[model samples]
Target: MNTTPASSPPAPVAALVQMTSGIDPDANLAAIDRAMGEAAAGGASMAFLPEMSLLLDRDRARSAPHIAREADSPWPAALQALAQKHGLWLHSGSIPLLADDGERRVNRSHVIAADGSIRARYDKIHMFDVTLPSGENWTESSAYAGGEALTVVETPLGKMGLSVCYDLRFPELYRAMVDRGATLIAIPAAFTVSTGEAHWHVLMRARAIETGCHIVAAAQSGTHADGRETYGHSVAVDPWGIVLADAGCGAAAGDGGYRLSFAPVASAAVDRARQAIPLARSRANRRITL
Candidate 1:
């Protein structure tokens, strides 16, 4: 009865759902609901949603079920329902999950099965604490607690790694993830228009090339009412760092991150026909310190 191989890889062809969110979680949920319906109707086998899929607020822990939305929160129920309804696996790239410490919140990413079961949870380890040149500043460490461990889950898509918006800036984190057997990565971000235009695609491509993994990055593009301008170039990159699909601004003004930021996690359907380029090979021009 045990005829299956222990090391068979998963299928390729992942779907990256990009969106634009605001302060209202309910409206955000409604948008994603409609988006998911459309994506499913379009024959997308899986979907990946971006960070703050349910809520984007300066207020602390408002999106967490226990904090603001509670059980009545539409995010969990809707995500579960959407997955079950479409018979697709969904990756909630990040959410305002209740933190281990009651005082703070966790920027957590959840992996949900088609049956509405939660397979894994990854709290963002690195926070986006930066003061941009344009006088815009974000202090994520103030209201949120950082995670200590990394998360990699086994799925129909193979080993799945978790990451959030600011995490994209840290390649060592991704390097660590890929070394731990992550063949596919999901990046859900609300990146600033400045950084997004300058480094977003380059960073995504670099991560994929270094890890030999396929990446599906869904971004928040456009200017938000919060006076924040986000870069909105959602991209899907292959293992060799080829950007296959780029959600460019058609007629949208400016490279704001709020053009659209809702996204989903699809199954890891990668073209493994390409050679397994391990990160070890990237140790190019290493000195013989031994």
Candidate 2:
């Protein structure tokens, strides 16, 4: 009987891309191509992109044509080509696609292998339907349906959990992912300037610390053609909650501009963090009495 456990994969370098996407899908694809090329040249095994990586148009009337079914849309094929061209795996942040019902869209993420094949897909489970203190209202649920299942996939970097913007507020989702053996989690977002400045860093570090998993967040930055502003600061954090890299905000992430940052994803770091605290063991032993 073979009882030996599978060994963890070696660490791989990941590239985080912070972009300021507008309403144009073609331009966004070009930006991604440029970034992927740079990531490959810089020795990144995989590249992570921000949410709404393709089209960020909030105007339903204008974005309707672009938010077609995944099978029908050309964007996925285009992205596959880019991955194959760069010979790198790609974590497509999130794209809006028409749901099966055809009445609403779903915010979905794709994990593409180096061979240009899609290994996994995750739809954003949480909806951002808040009216910020700045009076900026966002009703994501109006246009998008929440996803039903959690997604964790194996990559050269490690077992990765996928989540999109607004999902960060839900801790249970991340805990569930950790229970499923995710050593790293991706939280690609298009955060508003106001809430982002308040909770982005704090929440990101908290997730990493609580799960003992590395957190890689690619973000959208600067003002967009739709008259909305996003918080930049694309960041990568280790399992110990240390920020490995952060692409800062403001002019450095101006509209139509993009920034790339790199971080090392190692199983050793996950091992050290989990072994130091052993939170999982403690949680399993505890009994919650209401």
Task: Tell me the lDDT of model 1 at 166.
Answer: 83
lDDT of candidate 1 vs native? Answer: 0.70
Per-candidate TM-score against the hidden true structure: 0.81, 0.94
Residues 1-290 of candidate 2: C-alpha lDDT, one tens digit per residue: 99999987656899999998889999999989989998999999999999999988889999997889898899889999999999999999998899988889999999999999999999999999998899999999988999999999999899999999899999999999998999999999999999999999999999999999999999998888888899999999999999999998843534336798999998899999999999989887889953
Best by TM-score: 2
Instruction: Compose the digit string of candidate 1's lDDT tens values, residues 1-290.
Output: 99977974434445666666667666666766666666666656567777776666664434344343224345676788878987777887677855654777788777888898888888888888999887778899987888888888877667878888888888889888877988888888888877777888899998888777777777665555445656767787777777778777421444222233222233332444134543365465567763
Q: Where does model 1 exceed 4 Å of error?
A: 1-12, 59-74, 250-290
Q: lDDT of all predictions, in order shown? A: 0.70, 0.92
TM-score, cand. 2:
0.94
Clash list (residue pairs), candidate 2: none
